[model samples]
Target: MTGPRIALFAEGGDWHAARLGESFAARGAALVRLSLDRAMLATGTETGVELPGFDDGLPDAVLVKTVAAGSFEAITLRLGILHALRDLGVPVWNDARAIERCVDKAATSFHLARAGLPTPATWTTEDREAACRIVARECGQGPLVLKPLFGSQGRGLLLVERPEDLPPPEATGGVHYLQRLVRSPAGLFEDYRLFVVAGRVVAAMARRGATWITNVKQGGEPLPFTPDARMTRLAVAAAGAVGADYCGVDLIRDEAGRALVLEVNSMPAWAGLQSVTPVDIAAAIADGLLAALPQRRQLAAAGG
Candidate 1:
């Protein structure tokens, strides 16, 4: 049996690409790490190289990561590339449209809230005065988490314990997404990143930190944790809400001892989850990708 060829995208993701590749390779699948960032634009040339450094041909699927904002032309060009890949019938992880929504914290929050899933109580306003007022009122004693409309890896998050402590509104387009802070136990300033692949929670683990932030990139430690039925259900629900077959749902316990989703990463990095949990998250991802392939369409069309 030949292995399914996988292409992992973007730069600085070589480690994860390697992890997933190794996981799939161990399972008899050939995984290829293609750093899309290697396709650098030159001073005058157009149509930068594709499939560089390898002669393995286009992949059966690709796991996308890292997107940089650029001028209108660049934005359109990048998006056109994504759409073109999907049009070519290659399976892209996090799915294509899912990437568009999950990258924006504000938009994802709105969509999750609309689906009646539990998310942090949030108020987004370009009106600085209004944003400040809400944070002042709702976050009286507990901390308030101020997030960039587009943030990841727990970066650009502000733990505004006081109203006067927040940055000036003009700093972030005069708008803010303020959520009521939820604190974990004293010993564990941790949260769970529920790994969902193919609408199921493949792995569940907690992160412990000294502060409210608990991302591995933020010096937090990943620890093993079990997913109760509630966590499983909600995590799956959150993924479905975001229209992603693969994602990481960030869950924190609220005052009521219930899990409340804080954020959903459409293109979630599973290095931590893979490390802590016994599940082969990469294989789950590969399985999901294979299941979503166009071959299913052909089989259905032929009445197989």
Candidate 2:
């Protein structure tokens, strides 16, 4: 079989993109790395999609590494392009639907709960009074973690220890997403980031945080972790719940030592997780994506 051509969507010339390009090249797959901002979409075109340096045609599949922040319209258009590509029968690993669901914290929580996965109690509301009520109730029990509805890398996160410390809904960009803070019995702030690919846990690592937030981007240190059955099962289930072809599932253990799903990232970065784990994550991802191309073609042939 001919090697499948792949389109890697990310911020151009970044470390992750460059590394992925090298991995794909080593696997004998052609890769076209371009930003979503550069992919043109139109109504009257052959494929209705025009990516930079792909004058021949679209690739066999698309791998989304990063979807840059943009205005509402810009973001919508970029997602629309991915949607269009899927409608045209090209496989989009972690397609637009999964990306949209994972990007919205509220949606991710709902899906996890629907799949019977344990997640922190979360409340989101546009009404300031209603949001404040949630904060008061949660604070009465324990500290609350206020997070942006659409964010990652632990940015814009706030710990509401006191009811009076709660910010208004407007401060949360017109929506308050609060979760009950889960404490570790040992009083150490840590969590597990399990990287799942194609419904399997490819690699995992424990993150030790300087404070309550254990995200690597928040100054946490990554340590090698051998995932137990429970952790691996929960991570895989969470990824399936979010409809991700590949993802990073964050698992935090509460005071009772029972793990709870924290978040599922559809376009997860593996640099930190790679440092501690011996797994060549880039190669694994490349193999999974390449394997998917043949399966996609077979499905199309079978009218699936």
> Which candidate's TM-score is highest?
2
Using all chains and alpha carbons, the TM-scores for the candidates as numbered come to 0.82, 0.96
Candidate 2: count the clashes: 0
Alpha-carbon local distance difference test for all models: 0.74, 0.89
Candidate 1's residue-wise lDDT over 1-304, tens digit each? 6767766665664566666776777766666665544433332432222455434445666677655567767655665556555555556675557777788777888888999998888888888778778767877667788988877788888877666877987666567888878866444587898988887888889998877788899988999999899889999999988888788999998656778988899877778777888887777877777666677446535654
For candidate 1, give the lDDT: 0.74
Which stretches of candidate 2 lie above 4 Å from their native place? Answer: none
Candidate 1 local Cα displacement, residue 179, angstroms? 1.1
Give the Cα-based TM-score of candidate 1 against the true structure.
0.82
For model 2, what is the error of residue 288's alpha carbon versus the real structure, in angstroms, after optimal superposition? Answer: 0.7
